[model samples]
Target: MADKSSNASKKSFKNIDDTQSYVHHLVWLDKNIENYTNQQKLNQWHELDDNIKLFSHEEECINYIQKQNDKNTESYIIFIISDSCSEQVIPKIHNCLCILAIFILTTNSENCQILNYPKIRATCLDTSDLFNRIRHCIYRDEASIGFSLLNKQDSTDAEPISLETKSNEQYPIRNLQEDQARFLWFYKCHNFMIELEDDDRQAKEEMISYFRIKYNKDKRILKPIDEFEKESLQDNAKNAIWWYSHNTIMFRSMNEALVSGHISTIYSYRYIIKLLCRQLKTLHKEYKKSISNNRLHLYRGQRLKLSLILLISNHINDLISLNSFVSTTLEEDVAKKFCLGRSKNNDEAVIFEIDIDLNSEQNIPFADIRDVSRYPEEEEILISIGSVFRIISVNFDEEKELYRIHLTLSQHEQLIVNKYIEQTFATEIDSDDQSILFGKLLFDMGEFEFAIKYFENRIRCLSDHNNHYRPTYLNNTGVCYNQIGDKDRALKYYKKASDIYKETKNQRGLGACYHNIASYYYDKGDYDTALRWALKALNERQQYQLEKASTLDLLGCIHLAQRDAEAARNNLQEALRIRVKYLSQLNTNHPDIGISYFNLGKLDSKLSSLIDAQNNYSRAEQIFRHNYPKTHPLITEVTQCLEQIKRQL
Candidate 1:
């Protein structure tokens, strides 16, 4: 039975290629570690000394060790095994570990007949511990004598080493493999290291006691642990318990930081998520392997959960990165707006509930909802306002702290809806304020259909009562409809808005309405009519330099469509100049800036200045990538244009 077990162990590890197998064993050994020295801890030691190597995973450690073995140099290694170590790799690579130990042990053996041991630290020790012990044996005993004893024993017996042998028996050696016996020595050393830590603590305590006695007698050479010294002691004490529930502590800290508005804590949470992503990716590779073997049942559910976590982590990082640009005061204002909905005059509060998705809901609880009148009539009541969520149910789940309401938006819509609730709700609002907000937020979120709905609602409310500001809402609604491809309805609304603007003698309103009309013509490929209206808009917007630049860009597009490169270049350059002047006041990643860059790039492309075109297109791409989701139309458009430029080059 002993011979058979030895033969099986040999067969199991005989085919290992190299040190990679040892990495596999180490990875497997640390699979179920509850606490780890996090990467952040390792980072603190980085650059302190060149001899220290820190690795986040096993493969890197293996490669580093292989290099060190080649140089035959003494160095330190810190390995951070992530949470994904378990249920992924198995311990089938024990042979390489033995081989590596043998290489270390036999170093300089040809000259001195003695072996030297290399220092290795990992999360855990397994069968490889025996190999380490063999190295230690060569160091402890006389080199030549040790070699002779091993050689004589090997020549005298065909039997494998037995772990249970007694000194009086013929084969007194342990009935274990040569490599397995070394584990005993490794266990002894590990226990000794633990004892050293305890001993050091006790020695420090004794020295402090002696100092206190001396201070009591001579009043010198001894001082109490001050507050600073006490803090240092407490920090050192925590090192003992650092691993216990560290992951749980990270999540709790993140939650506290988020609630307390600590930006640094939010950043730390992002880093933690990034690390988890790396761990999950490693586990996912194992899951794929299990699938090919028809053993996916073992990990399919776990894989699904990990994938969900990875997805959420990516989204959260994106949100936090975007929010870093917003001011703290602005964030507070937005929070207040969403937390204080308006109350109705009938003594009933307007309960605003946001349906996040099919599986989840959230109620917006307002602490002090005040009744506000929109129209002059006291009977008219406005319940709620936002571009994102429509009321499905007002029911609140007091017990669960979540509202069980169905969201009417799709997945993408829900994301933008939540974003609007977070970013744009930074000011007090009433029913009349809804029209402007709904148009702006929905337009910004790329929800043109919903934007038009709110704009039309606002227009209807004003037109029904003969409000003089009806034309402005009409023009805004026309822009939204035009964005959604309802060209005929867009034209009708534009004409009505144009007529009303003329009646009111609102030059700015007329210019903006004319630009929309010109935009419609441009989309229809009627460059002549588009150019005519664009020029009219430009002329009226000349006094408003900011608005004038936009009209100039539109004119440039119209000219470019007509194949007039020179005119397009002139108009686009002027627009770019105007945009640059206001760059400091505007969001650096404003969509309009990207559009201007894109238009300039297009004109340069038409002129066959591929280098200039590429540069401009690159600028546009950067802005679009930074400001919008990857799938946004503007980003997609810029990507397509950049690809075309690459082809042209």
Candidate 2:
């Protein structure tokens, strides 16, 4: 076998668990993807090796390589960046796509203005620079830790993220000229580490086996899609509703709400890749069974195992590659190679579970293993979406080198919505729409602080186009603030939204602004002010049948709180009608259905409809418990209320 030690010790390959080589991050690039695409004009990658080095500051390194090396056999790539590019001007991945853009030149230069791409500071990073840096331990090779996207990319207008917990004690910066001889380096290595649990493997095998059987056993041949059974119909929002006085079945439809981002939202289910990974081992057992029965060739099991490995690896590779730039790791490929620095006989790093404390000293031993037996007990074991880092412990090598130590964020927070006022008035689409979407996800995930930053990023991007987007951004900002209990900021934004709306003939915008402002006032116990705004918004929304759900719901709550029993009943009934009709098309088990039911139950209880309230409450409780964690506070509260109500009965 090849001396694994020597090859591994040289280390720093592109596809390692701890380190990634090709991780490209274009911060705030999501905001202006079009600008980058246009500026980079990705059609000239092959012809511009020299130009590529200019942005990465690797011109000197490339020159050094060409001069010193005899034949230049190293088939490595160097990236070139543009000096004028900002986050809005740079593409997110400085990779093959960026390179291919130049060669592909899909659009004519005359039509260039038609495409808007986010851009990055185009520079070059050469293999020579990377190699020498690995030898010397110089961090000049490290990408400058830029401020948050809120700071205008063209100028340094940013609040640098603060590190609440410091990373590990700082080592003295290293000199690049001096070889690895000067630094005490620890080499790393990696191997494919299995993670599939027995039960998980079984489930996967069952799923696949079921599919295979369905595919092969007495197969009804594939039929054309156009030939179908008689179409079925249901009493759904998609269907027409007939209205009558006594036996009226109302079907109110919701406009299909785009989950904001063009990207599909990952929900509680549909984690296909993860699901398959979990069940691979079960198929392994089946593989053995087939082999023993003399019905399977040796290669068959190997093929399946290989497929499983490749599948798992590809998923991980994707995660690493996509997140590499943002995580400040070399792209995933480079990070993967970081593991090769160790021996095959050495401890193989199965995983890397790290909480990067963006600020304070954190001991991120560059290498780790999946020593599940020796794992630390932490509050939450966080394995991110990209790169399932298996910490490979116990690979100590004196000759190993640290190519670069990156300065990156250790923590994340979600920012609550604010500044709906800004959103309403803003005319141009935000350059950082992706970040805004990410922020929304964080909000949905309850990472309020992080969400706030994303929305703020969108808000800042709208500064230039404030006249058009100001209302919506401001409104969103206000909503975020309200969620986080920042009443002052929320009110400020809501008022701004109101002012912006007054400039428009849009009653919908006006109503939304008034309603949220009323909510803020109500939350603060400013009953009179709350009532005035709510009534105003309600009266306006009463004109538009399309968006009456929110208005009615808010009105119902307002009336219920004020003990206006008759008004509350009417509003709640209307809101419930809207909600039920809208939800009818969804699966009965959907969590939102439970929320609507719970709200209806609350209204019923307030009106002393004990049996009706009890039934709705029971439905709500089942859905909530099934969809949410047992420890969820909402679940606990609902359970407690239900018990109390039952005791009253």
Candidate 3:
């Protein structure tokens, strides 16, 4: 039996490479794993880590650990072996670099302890003791918060982005800095959570169903899930903080999903997220009225990787946003103890000293949750997710052997972001629905894949095929496909939207679809077909000035392709006049206006008006450079045109 088990283990771990995505893995090897009927014992094991992988053979487990080492992945493995195979398996996997610790599950732990394997951290005869020891190891090794830094220079240099559909493209160009884009995306998501409306019973049932499927075998978690479902029949929002503070399935799953940025998981857990935020807001209001201090200081301690420490050190004056709900304390010693705890070799202990100004009119909320907390003695202060703070200073505490980072609540960074959001969305795509707004924001940020998924989800939820927003969703999905270079799929969705618009007599939707079709034909070099669609779009869009301008721009491009310089010039100039007059009222540097200037420059060059061409090209270059990255295609093309005109002069 032992030899057969060893052979099965070797063959089973051929696919061990799939576990690379996990930062920490738990591997349990017991020959009787299939026959193990101890539900309570299994529940205790799962509490240590929900994603435990069970194996019935020792050889397979050893191969899995060796494979992890071979890949040199940045992950640690906790290995648990039954007594029957412990002596043989420990000697094989103990030397593997990825193995963090080894546990011997035995009937006689005292006898096993005499083996003296340096990697063996514990010899456990019972599950409770084993759970405690493993929990400590996991916490000590992986105690950190997820955060992203926005350099001060990057934010200061970021110009207002223009969300104009450029010529020969189906969607608008986006060039926001990467960090700024993520920050705004999450901020929008937070707002969406607050505004989302769903039946509490339905949302809670959905959440419970999801976890029940995940932990079908573990009764420890299932019991709480059942209790939560029963308690949710009452006032769930009032107890949201208690559930969040308690180390249960809700707390673990939500935090893990938030830190990993798993969109699907977060959506499944939205009910709890919304509940927690709403409760926190109410508490924040009352807490503000009760406090008399003009300023308050808070501290949080954790171990971070050296790479993250260096990143924070290098960007001292920049902005940082915590990606999850942050827990801090008013007592410095409590926080200090957390940092001073055991940490991995590549980690450094750090304490975050956060200052809050009570007088400032900041939108982000934080509250003392002692009254509603699961552990009130801890005196926890919970800061809402997506909170932005400025890194005031960072210093090393020589005597304490740790680093101290100073952060202060600031809305200056958010103010800059607000301008960009207003300019990008407020003037265009005017929709009050938060879901639509968030989907469009993702599309504008060049997150085509995410945008596609979001639109599809929205479409599925809509019951009416002729719903007012159906055409919009279909058209946006098509545009996302086009951006990703899928022309056939793009055209299919465009035609679907066109059919819906025609049936519903939504003139505006029909006009947008016609413009998209024209753009598609224009890209294919079908000048006559492109002209026909552009004219149809113009007829439908006459009442909408910006939409009319877009159609005229398409007409000018088609005429230019047909070698009618005189006709192209007429159309281009008309388009330019309308765009300048309308867009100046909103943003002077709108990219649609820049697109007009570039098209006119091409027309002037064809007409041999060199000086006129130079002026138009120069204007286009200025706008493109300000609103886009230096390497953007528009900037590159305009720069090349200027160099040619200069040489001719």
Backbone collisions counted per model: 10, 152, 1
| lDDT of each residue in 1-649, candidate 2, tens digit only | 2322333445443322221112221111122234433434433221223223222223343343344233332222322232333222323333222221111121233324443432211112432332222211111112121111111112212233222222432111111111111010000000001121222333234433443454454232111101111112222111111110001101000001011111122211112223322233333344233433322110000001111122222222111111111121212232322222112112232212222332233222121111211111111111121121221121212333212111122211111011111121122124244333334334433445545654565566555645555676677678778777797898898888778878866567778788898888788777678889888988778765424666676676777788887787787677667655754444344444566567678878887787888898888776654334333445667778788678878
**Which segments of candidate 3 are over 4 A away from where they belong?**
1-143, 153-178, 199-216, 229-234, 262-265, 412-417, 427-430, 485-505, 565-649
lDDT for 328 in candidate 2 is: 19
**Two-way lDDT contest, 1 vs 2, winner:** 1
Ranking by lDDT: 3, 1, 2
Tens-place lDDT per residue, model 1, 1-649, is 1222222222222232211001111211233232332565334223222233334455655555455445533221222232243112112222122222121111122432221222121112322332333322222111110000011112212343222323332211112112211222211222222233323333345434543554565321222222212434335343211211121233334333333222223323333222222333333344334433321110000001111122222221121111111111112222121112111111111122222232332221111111221111111111110112222332323432222222232121223212223332332122234335445544554556756765675565553656466776777778778777888799898889899789878888888889989999999999999999999999888887767889999999999999888888899989988877765244554556778999999888888899999999988876654444344567678778889989999
Name every residue pair that clashes in candidate 1. Answer: 130-182, 130-183, 161-174, 161-175, 161-176, 162-174, 162-175, 162-176, 163-174, 163-175
TM-score leaderboard ranking: 3, 1, 2
Error in Å for residue 126 of model 1: 58
Model 2: how far residue 557 lies from native, Å:
1.6
C-alpha root-mean-square deviation, each candidate: 31.9, 25.0, 12.0
lDDT of residue 420 for candidate 3: 44
Off by over 4 Å in 1: 1-434
Q: Which digits, one per residue and each the tens of the lDDT, describe model 3 over residues 360-463? A: 88677799999998557557889987787888866666577677888988773453444445565553543766777777766655567878987887788788
Between candidates 2 and 3, the one scoring higher on TM-score is: 3
lDDT of 2: 0.36
